[model samples]
Target: MTPIRRYATAPGVPAAVGPYVQATSAGGFVFTTGQIPAAPGQEIGTFADEVRATLTHLAAVLAEAGSGLDRIVKLNAFLGSPEQLDVYNQVYETFFTDHRPARTTVCVGLWGVALEIDCIAVTGPGGDA
Candidate 1:
C-alpha cells in the first residue's frame, strides 16, 4: 500500500467546523470531506448558491490532492430539503457536464447547510508526479 498523504489549501480552510483533513490520498484515491455551503459564518443561503459554493470548495480540495473535478468517480450529496433537488441538479450539471461521475443524493436534516457534497477521485495517470 502506498503511504497516504494529506493536504490543506494554502492559508487553509478555517476550523470553525470539524477537524477532518480537507482531502486524503492513498493508493491513487483522493477522498474529500463533506463540504457544506458555508460562507465561513454566513448561512447557506439558497439551493443554487449552496451548490455553487460547495462545489467550488470541493474543487479546491481536489486540486490540493493532485486531482480535479474531472477525475471524480463518485459523489455523495446531502440536501436539507427535497425541494432543492431540481435546482441542485441544474447547478451540478453546470460544473460536471463532461465528467459525469456516479452520484448519490439524499435529503437529510443537515444542521447548518442547504446542502453538502463530497467526492472520491482517482488521481490522473501521471499519478501525482
Candidate 2:
C-alpha cells in the first residue's frame, strides 16, 4: 500500500473524519476528500451556501498541497436534491472560474450533507490556462 503525502497547518480547516488527510498526493495526482458545509459546527444554510463553503475549504486544502482549484482536472458532486442542480452549477461556475474540470453530478437518496464535493487535481504550481 502506498501512503500519500498529507499537508496541514496550525490554523486550517478542521476535518470531521478521524483519519482523513487534508489532501492526498499520489500517482501524479492530488485527491481531496469530500468537503461539506459543516465548518467547525457552523450551521449550514442552503444547498448553494454549502457548495460554496465546501469549495472554499477544498481550495484551501489544494493550496496546502501545493495545488489549487484551477489545477483540478475532475470533480464528483453529490446532491441530496435534484432541484438544486441549477443553483449548484451556478455557484460552481462562480468559484471554479478558470478550469472547468470534467465533473459528475449524482442525485442520491441522501448525502452526508446538503451538498458534497470531492476533487482530483494535478499536483503542481500553475493556474489553468
Candidate 3:
C-alpha cells in the first residue's frame, strides 16, 4: 500500500502565490514548494529583504509540517540576479546558523521577486524518525 501524502499550511506563512500548497509530507520527509519573497498584501522589497522573507516563510512551512530549518536536508535557492548572491548568502547564513544543509543556488528570472527558496526536511526530532 502506498503511504498517504499530507499537506501543510501555516497562518504565519504567506499563502501560495500560485496553484500549489505550501508544503507536503510523505514517507518521513517534508517537501516545501519554492517560496517567493512576496507575502500576502505585503510589498516586495530589496534583495536582502526578499531573501529573509522567503526563508522565514520556508521555516514556517517546515514547522507546520513537523519539521524545521535545522531538519532540512537540502535546499534549492533561486536568485533573480547573480549579483545578489552575496547578499543572499549572508542573510541565509543568519537563519541557518550551524545547520549546514546541502544546497544549490542559481540565477533565474522571478516575477516581481528577488529570490525564492525551497527545501526538503526529515520529520521528527533531529530528523531522525
Give me the candidate number with maximum lDDT: 3
Model 2 ranges off by over 4 Å: 1-3, 8-11, 39-42, 126-129
**1 or 3, which is superior by TM-score?**
3
Give a tens-digit lDDT track for model 1, residues 46-96: 668878888888887888788988899899999989889999999999998
* lDDT sort, best first: 3, 1, 2
TM-score of 2: 0.83
Alpha-carbon local distance difference test for all models:
0.80, 0.78, 0.82
Give the range where candidate 2 is weakest over 10 consecutive residues by summed lDDT: 8-17
- Model 1, residue 45: what's the lDDT? 65
Query: If both were scored by lDDT, which would come out higher, candidate 1 or candidate 3?
Result: 3
Clashing pairs in 1: none
User: Which candidate has the highest TM-score of all?
Assistant: 3
Distance from true position, residue 106, model 1, in Å? 0.4
Please give the range of 10 consecutive residues that has the lowest summed lDDT in model 1: 8-17
Model 3 spans with C-alpha error above 4 angstroms:
40-44, 127-129
